[model samples]
Target: MYALLQSTAVAPNSLTVIDFLADFVKFWQIIVFVFGAYQFWANRRERLAADKVREAQELLDSNYQAWLVVNSAQGKGGSGGRIDALTNLARNAQSLAGVNVDGAWLVGVDLRGADLAHASFKDANLQGALLSGANLKHANLEGANLSAAQLEGTMLQGARVSGARFSAASLLRADLADLVGWREIAAVNYARLQEIQRAPHGFREWAVEQGAEGNAVSEDMSAENFSTQFRAV
Candidate 1:
């Protein structure tokens, strides 16, 4: 009888040990689950942030390419004249502000009403390009080929036109106020005379005395009518 009572006491102690082990295992499982959930949430947040950065980079690249296409379309003869590319750029001209297309070929491209402020087109081929109403304020066109390019109502305030060719380019009603390096422009007689009427005060008469014909400005011409004639068609 005494041995049987001792065996019963040992069985209770073993049961207590088993219950303790079970509690410990449950605690460990809860800790692991919390840690795993935290890691998953952190990884998701990182992925979202990376996606946003990539999207921004893609948008910037697209804008840069648009500017390049328009610049390349401004080529002379066989070098340029991609009408489809020019059409695409014209449709998205608002994104072209401050684009850098330096030394590009842009002959005969239609760039009407483009926002080209602070853009770099230095030494670019803009021969016969349609640039009516373009915002060329503070733009760099130094040594660029602008022969026969349209410039009606274009803003040339603070623009650098040094060594730029304007052989037969039309400047009718174009704003040339405060143009940088205006005296150094390589312009023919017709090009020089076309913008003389818009020159500041005595500058017009001075140009006329310098052999620039002053009869190009019609007395019956009005600013509204002049702008209408040069509107992009």
Candidate 2:
């Protein structure tokens, strides 16, 4: 009779131990689930915070410079967090035209298809920048370093290119339809271009005179400041 009583006591202890183990596992699972939810919510909030429209609206109610607003909560930062801010500014469709962005350090910036019409990029470091299909009409690009920049299909109609470097830059089919004087100063070394015959009148003859291999080439790194930016594209 005593042994049966001991056996019953041991059975209850075993059940209690099992219950404790189950509770411990449940507690840890709850912690893990809470942590995961927190992470997801944090990431979602970050993306929402980078919205250009929201920032624009906020600007109306706050005191901030348009340039300072370019920095996106800054994870995808460029040289000195300028990339994030510049990108946001470029994407925002609010009267960017005629804004003076002269001498901006925008190296390797991906501004494809942004409406940069009439914006002054004079003397800017645009090396290896992706500006394809972007509107640069009537913009001032004087003395800009566009080496290896992808300007394919960019609208450069009436834009100024005085002393601009196009070394190894891709200007294939760029809308230089109204640009003047590029043939005199544009450095087209290894640059991609339309067939000389298909190019705007006089571009092909100019390419052959410059001794390019089926393309226009110029060895003039005018002012020796133009450096090659080994672009992958």
- How high is the CA lDDT of each candidate model? 0.68, 0.68
lDDT of 1 by residue, 85-130 (tens): 5445665655456766566766777879988788777888777788
Worst 10 residues of 2 by lDDT: 221-230
Alpha-carbon error at 5 in model 2, in Å? 56
TM-scores, all models, native as reference = 0.55, 0.57
Q: Give the number of the best model, judged by TM-score.
A: 2
Q: Compared with the true structure, what per-residue lDDT tens digits does model 2 show for residues 25-116?
A: 99999999999999999998888877866886786533244465543322222355455555655666444567565666778887788788
